[model samples]
Target: MDFVPLWAVVIDYILGVVMWTLIGRFGMGLFLPENTSFFFMRFFVQATDPLIRLFRPITPGFLDARFVPLFVAWFFYMARFYLMPWLLGYSVMGMLSFPLEGEIARGLANILYKFQN
Candidate 1:
């Protein structure tokens, strides 16, 4: 296997962790009010704020500012499912798309597939 694809897979895992954290932060916000003093909430906000800011201008105005996390998550989803594979010269559908489960499973599967051949 090429190093480029392996590097892409590592990035995929990192994106998965960040994407899920963004989703969790958004979901938690629905129940708990924002308080910087709170640990998890603060961590979530600090962790995801930069990413949200990076995407905010491009995200549709119709989307409320509070939905920035979701918007960024969508961007990551697109990168993982579409952009990465395209860059690697593979069709989007040819690679495992869902990132919530982490990349270990996919990486292991790739190793096993290579061994099988």
Candidate 2:
């Protein structure tokens, strides 16, 4: 019997998307300057700008501006790793506690497996 609630799954999935997007912005920032006209970089910047702003108070002032996305992503990661299970009445974190990332990794692994065969 599954004990996890549907609402928890949905919230986790949404937070997962935000966390991944923040990390993506950090990765892409390595290759593109903030003011560059590249479409993907622009999209990432626009999408995560609000989140960055929201987390600004907690963000460390010593971090290079380029690293803020990664810092914000870490906050999300911690929330999912610790807070999610606590909210769901679990005493410990499960392997699949992060549903969206687990599903994505499984899908990618399956695709790689098929390609290898």
Give the per-residue Cα lDDT of candidate 2 at 21.
92
Which whole-number lDDT from 0 to 100 does residue 25 have in model 1?
Answer: 81
TM-score of each: 0.72, 0.87
Per TM-score, the best of the predicted structures is: 2
Candidate whose lDDT is highest: 2
- Model 2's lDDT to the true fold? 0.88
Instruction: Estimate, for each residue in 1-117, the C-alpha lDDT of model 1 and write its tens digit.
Output: 344556777778887888888897887777676575778988888898888878767988888656778778877777778877777787545374544464467888899999999
Q: Tens-digit lDDT track for model 2 on 18-89? A: 998999999999889988899988999999999999999999899999999999999889888888888887
Give the clash count for each candidate.
0, 0
TM for candidate 1 is 0.72
Candidate 1 regions off by >4 Å?
1-4, 92-94, 98-117
